[model samples]
Target: MKNVEPKVPLAVAGSSGFLPGCEGMRGAAALGVLLTHVAFQTGSVTESFWGRVWGRFDLAVALFFALSGFLLWRQHARAARGLSASPSTGRYLRHRIVRIMPAYIVVVCAVLLLLHEARGASATVWWANLTLMQVFVPYSLVEGLTQMWSLSVELAFYLLLPLFGWGLWRLRGEAARWRVPVIVTIAVLSLAWKYIPVPTADGVHHDNWLPGYLSWFAAGMILAEFATAPPPRMVRLARIPMLMPIVAVCAIGIAASPLAGPPGLVDLEPLEYAVKILCGAVMGYALLAPIVLAEPGRHHRILASPTALMLGRWSYALFLWHVAVLMVTFPILGVPQFSGYMFPVLVLTVVLSVAVASVSYALVEEPARRALLRWETARAERYRRQNGNAETATAATVTKASA
Candidate 1:
């Protein structure tokens, strides 16, 4: 058998049979990001040790990348094999743009409008922020809602994925095989981060500085490719012996970091970054392993439950739209000072996230996905029919001519 065969996960393409644990992981990661957002917004980082811990939930950004990588690869590998598709990179790009834009536009505009009042910013600032280029162009966004950086990175990844996916798809020849290509690509991207002079505002520097977080995305893509491989013992070990404790430790670790303020003693930066990066990556693995490797069971019952699935399904919309919603609604309600009662803010965040997400997915992302499938499916059918007719017509015409 070819080396590529073993790399393909036994699960059929677009398998809804995913271990629900993955759905749980999505919700959990989204919530983790929400926590980090709240912590960042409050500038409560030094307020206490707990604040510090909550601060680290920001690592959910990594978890989000990893999970997206696994699923996108899983689906694309199964679907990208038809002539009509031309691999349909154009369609893929369109779908991504449409799926993400409506809600994103709404949210970015809402934030800008709020900022307009709060800081009297000019339309130029609004224009740059709305376009998502500010983060790359060296303009600092409004301080309060600058969490858009992660969104910027995610948008950048979305832009490159079809091209990246196409390149990897082309490597699926008989000789070099998928495994070599995947491993090589992963190693190269990772090493580039370690060595390449990635562009920055300063114009020349390696990716090792700042959150040159692209390496993690490449890691995620690598994981996605490998998920198709035959199950290894390590894959099983991840969910059982490995993943559980790792997630617990990460949760506890973030829970302990204090918010920013004088209430904190000396900073834990030395040990803090260490624990978060290490544990965060591990937690990301644990979250993904079950979905990628384990037998489908409602093992994460809390997550696999119907409500969570709905939330998970629309989580992206929910996340993109929630910040603006919260910003608009919270102040109007005269939100009380943060303290032990802060849980209410979290509740509002979840509710609004869920509401916005449900609307966005039903009206926007889902319809956009359906449109792509319909267009592509029709195009594929046409090509098949045209090819079959050409073959038959040639045979008939030749017989008459021969006669």
Candidate 2:
């Protein structure tokens, strides 16, 4: 396909606006994650070549992490370059809390209260999952919410991102030159953290933690930095015909090989784990770079289409509800877990999950987000006005004393 540069340079866009097609990417990643879960539930992961491909769709989580990294870090990157100011720490945290926690809390409560398997869950389980701390505790993840491990990791990233942004901002004079390197170092440390021995209670997978997946996020952060200034080499690479799609295909192919480890719950050797991490980073970058860095093209237009944008808007709710929907789908279809009515079950689950997600978005997520954000804005404005009046009064008193 022919490549065109973005109409608005990423640096300018990074200040406040979204990179084009990002919503579509989010929608696609959410769907991929859903499909991966459904495949495992239906024993389709081990059924055939396509099944194996579906199993590897867990790579979508990497894409999700990467998208977060890129989008969230852009403003910070611009601030570091003195191009713009970052949000206040309090505002940032509030925004994140409002964006994620309300819908998540609703889902957690519904699952625990309504799901038969989760009905008898302990107080500790409720506490942990509600706070997104279930990944830290062993065997605390309840049924219909097992997929929340990644969400837990995402929350951890959200909490720490401001600190990371501050560290980047501190680079000052060296910020542009050192931004990518610093991020890469953190990513490397994250990978190395995987090899460090950490004691955990049985049933706890450290891989579910943010440290294990930080590299995937780092990949997106690096892309953010690159897109902000876009080196000539990167620009040329982006212009290459079919380059990104080829990279995406190759990365997926490699990730599907034995080197990336088995597509199951089996434990991975250190090497396999490392390979898998690398493959995920590469694949996520390949999938995202074009939309962020390259020009508008057929692929970009498709991703930015009205339908895809709608899916993206509801993606978070879709992700939150899909596993729960899948769990119930088994009973509704009279197909016991792993008994292989894969296709029909997938179709039904998608329909039901999408419907539920739409409702959740309309009735819960959007309203909550908008209300909180408006309140925050009004509070900030009032604070500014009060401060301005105080300063004006102080100046008047000084003038009168001088007179």
Candidate 3:
């Protein structure tokens, strides 16, 4: 894990329609969650200010799910590209495991090792975290690393990607041109459910719900398809109409939700998993809006501007490192005093997280990421070569028999 470069370029960089803004939105969303965790734990006046300004950055985690779906949607757009679905969904799953687990294991260990005093029972927390089932398990994992719930959900989603794709494919036939309506219907149903308030525990809050998020991935998959062959008219339309509603909904959701309750702003928790899923679906829409409505070009250069683009690129690694910095920072600041010294902690967290993440990209995630891709591609090329050789041998036998 020194500063090593990728041996092979990532497929998405040149091949997929994974334009810069998507990464920016994801990283920005991840950062928003980071701020929310900082605010929830340290309780600074500035954090309070932020919580009110945007309904707590915590709510944005749901948006991440939507972004996930939108990004993956591209893999499905193959028939549109004159190719069928890949023969093995298993390969995609293995890549996901390889991509996520390795760096997470490395970073979590580093954080726990660095900040032992900030939390208790490090051994047990580490165990729960490894399973990615810590959230469901009742016990807390990783000291003050409370932001892991969303990570657990994301891991679960990765497991379900193939199932999701199969279900989507079966819905209208993967090759059907009319599948757009099917996606819209599922998305709309999920969105409408957001209106119903979440039920209370002793009247307490449990913000996690399943239905609310599916729509986001579903939407992501839909758009992922477009990434393969983005429509011309949709790309050229005014301001990404597909994305507008989702943006509007998220803004409204935050505006309506409250933090630090007298009874805490009525939690949107009760609505069945469907509505939030719908919101996520819409989020998928917004993430892909710039590209789906049109291929990015001279007019769309704003979406990929250098400053914004750099932030997006570093966004994922930044997310991995941020919480640990906050945890160790809190004990130094003393949690009680964090409220008054909010400005310093916020600046410190951002600076350290970014620095650590830049290092993470250079050292751990990127290098391993490239090696895995190179290995996979090489295996694939060999398979093709072997298959072609067998076909040639079969043709030779037929020629000899005819003579």
Candidate 4:
């Protein structure tokens, strides 16, 4: 079969041409998550209109999942389309582990050791949180680390992605046409998983698991597929001025309404949960589509700016630390939980979280990533040299036999 080059847009093609706006979106998503947590803690989520809007900012988690799906799956998509070689599963897993675990483990340890409520936690609790397995066990979520369920779900997806990529790699000829449809079916089934009867147990929250949110990730994966070889319809849609942003805003507005269910800790009905899931997927996709599809422009430039890039670079650490910072802020400021100081608490938390996150990124995350990448490079070079020598010896033997 002839290898066909995918017609990827220049804005999102090679490494140098990757979308800068995605960095901005990541920064924005991190801020959204922090803001929502602050609103909930300050009792603003239940008190005011803006608070409700802030509450819906948990949609940022969907955005994070979507971004992960797109960015991580792109290589697989390219490989499926014959644009590039498939990524090595070992190297991919190594990169994913190094990218997330160093800073994550540091924050998990710090939170468990430092937080008053976590001081008396059992070893099981420590093990669960450290391994990002808190969501699997009932009652394992520590106070300051309650937000890590999403991270656990993310880790699950990371472990599962290589298998999914292998499946994609198996598509050949006409079978490749089913790729998008198959992914869409999986997304639908994942959403339907929410309706399956699972009895509630002490501290068990089924919604926190990966199944409930796979659709959001699938949305990004679908976009990744589209980006690799955009269909005529997608190209047309991307060219439509302001279409995606408008859809994103409208989805958000609907999500903010009662239709998507009450904010905070209230249990939602099945229908409400489905609505929230659909809205989140739509909103996240809408927000990200333009960045992936459109040509470079003012919006991209703004998002690609130095400040936004820095925020994006620090976004993961910021996410890991914000909830902990928010938890400590109430005590340090002498404000009671749910006491009405939303603005002040938000300000303080943002300031402290950013400071801590910057240090974590600089001293922990970046260094670990660089060190592992260097190791991977060295390992690859050694493998190449060994393979080269083996090939040379085999050729010599063949020549001698022919003589």
Candidate 5:
């Protein structure tokens, strides 16, 4: 992996240019999550077939994981190939923190301040979220935002990424050839762990844990591997125009069918549950393949459209605050469950979320991220200058001694 340039552009491909299609895909995923929560909140479509389809939007998390795996590995592999310097742990962590934290902290504090009466004023709950450890404790998991649990799961991946990349880096030749299968096997094991049925506090399940979703991440890693060193066969497969949409539609159908969602929830038997997980992972890959693999600007127009790009840019903030939007919208609009008002409420919720997210992205996330990056860059430059001067001084002393 280190010896060559990636034959194809990986997801979002670094600063040289953004993958507009991938951005659109991410925006769609965020919308899907928002719709899923809306469906859950209003008893509007829980029993209908289409309602079940909307509910299965929980699959968006799988997409999120895959994107993370693909993009992060691409960055790491690029560094390994000497396209860029390897980031120190602190610097890497700082980058991740600045990207996610400023907006997240603002949302957390805002939610607490606005909804203190509805949500308990527990200092521990505040601390848990501030540290991104909400998944460990039960109450904090759903305290400010139920969806934030996934963010915590993502944090676990962030911590594990460096070591995971190192392990993959150590393999050579035949062992490297086995990378995809090994990651797939691990993914299978992750799903299998959910079925073990360990005792837990009521309503708390293994779904919140990092292990349950490790396979989704692994699936993304597989895509990264193929993207970086495009096997001829895989590249050909990706180029097939109708392949991705067909697979994606089929995957969604399977998920929405009675087999996966009779009650607008994933309440299948153990074997069926495994099938659902596998299908969800497959769906994620199918949806992402074209976005990542298509010739730049040659893919679906909708994904690369201006609106999609704008939404995608704000997708992170959207994900963070969509639930809060719903919380506020329901009361402000006086939306009723299982009524015609639900659609308007949904529309209004999306609008409010997007508006708030746009402001937050511009005012908080973008500014903070840029400032932190600039600081890191300036620090590196200073260190380089000091080292260069020291080297010059040492060389002059050596020359004097020789003379």
Candidate 6:
């Protein structure tokens, strides 16, 4: 496949691996999660029109999944094409672990120890979360950090991407185009699987499992193909600035409607849930595509700013620690239920969560990532040296025999 010149500058232009405007999108998504929880905690999310809008913000998780799929698929696509250096499975796992684990572990410890949020859970629960198996291990969610269930699904996607990419890359001749269809089939199957009744202690089904959310990830994968090796039609469509916003508004409206879901929707009839998932997936794509595929600097201008990027850099930490911050802050303020102090409480929680997230990122996440990367580099260098020495010795022996 020859490289196709992009019709316009991409988000990948100025930055090397980092997508330019995506940090803002991520920050916004993380804030959306915070806002949803805050609204519910403050007892205001169901009271007004704005509150209902904010309550629907749980869709942000779908956006996060889409972002993960798009970004990870792009990395794997580059690796498959021999364009990226760190393509080995070990290196990929190392990077994911170092990037995700440090801050996550810190938050888990804080919730269990200082906050005493999950004082009742057994040792197995702690181990399950530490190993990123919370979703699989029933009743393993950390007390206030229930949001980490998304991380479990994210981890599953990380594990599966290499195999998925390798399989697609190996397709030859007439079989190549089948790759997209195969992925689409899997997404459809996942939605069908969502309707299968499964026994749970609680009557309501927990859709946190990967199968239920695979469509959102697959939607991102489809966009990733467009970003990396777009078809002519996709390129033409991406150039149209008006298309994305119009699609976004329509998709959001549909997702917000009674047909798809109600505000603060959790448990839904199976058919309604499936429809809601589809609408959410479409909305996620609309929200993300403009940032990803649009002409550089023209679309998503507000999200392109430095402030959003900085917040996004800490978004992971913010997502991990925000609930714990809420759990602790509420008690110290001494107002148990909804009250006049609710506004102050919400403001204080945000400030505290940000402070904690900033410190966690600066001290733990960045350092751990750099250290592991440096170690991997050194290890690769040593292996190269050993291989070079063996090759040189073989050449010398061959010369001696010829002489």
Best by lDDT: 4
Local error of candidate 2 at 52, Å? 1.7
Ranking by lDDT: 4, 2, 5, 6, 3, 1
Order candidates by TM-score, high to low.
Answer: 2, 4, 5, 6, 3, 1
What TM-scores do the predictions have?
A: 0.74, 0.93, 0.75, 0.92, 0.89, 0.87
lDDT of 3 by residue, 1-403 (tens): 6998665421222125456666666666777767666655554323244445433455467567766765555565564355455426777777778777877877766766666644345565678676666655555455545566677778877887676567666533444565566766765665555565656434222344344455656666666655554444444442544456567457435343342221112344434333434444444466456544443342235446776667677777777778887766766666553364666677778888888888887788788789899998999999999999999999999999999
Q: Is candidate 4 or candidate 6 better by TM-score?
A: 4
Candidate 4 off by > 4 Å: 1-17, 172-174, 296-299, 391-403
In terms of lDDT, the poorest run of 10 residues in model 2 is 8-17
Model 1, residue 210: C-alpha shift (Å): 10
> Model 1 residue 122 lDDT?
66
Q: What's model 6's TM-score?
A: 0.87
> How far in Å is the alpha carbon of 181 misplaced in model 5?
1.6
Q: Report lDDT per candidate.
A: 0.59, 0.85, 0.60, 0.85, 0.76, 0.74
**Which is the leading candidate under TM-score?**
2
Superposed on all Cα atoms, the candidates' RMSDs to the truth, in angstroms, are 6.2, 3.9, 9.4, 4.1, 4.6, 4.2
lDDT of 5 by residue, 235-272 (tens): 66767988977997888788777666365544466666
Deviation (Å) of 391 in candidate 1: 4.6
Model 4 clash count equals 0
Deviation of model 5 at 95, angstroms: 1.1
Clashing pairs in 4: none
Q: Of models 2 and 5, which has the larger lDDT?
A: 2
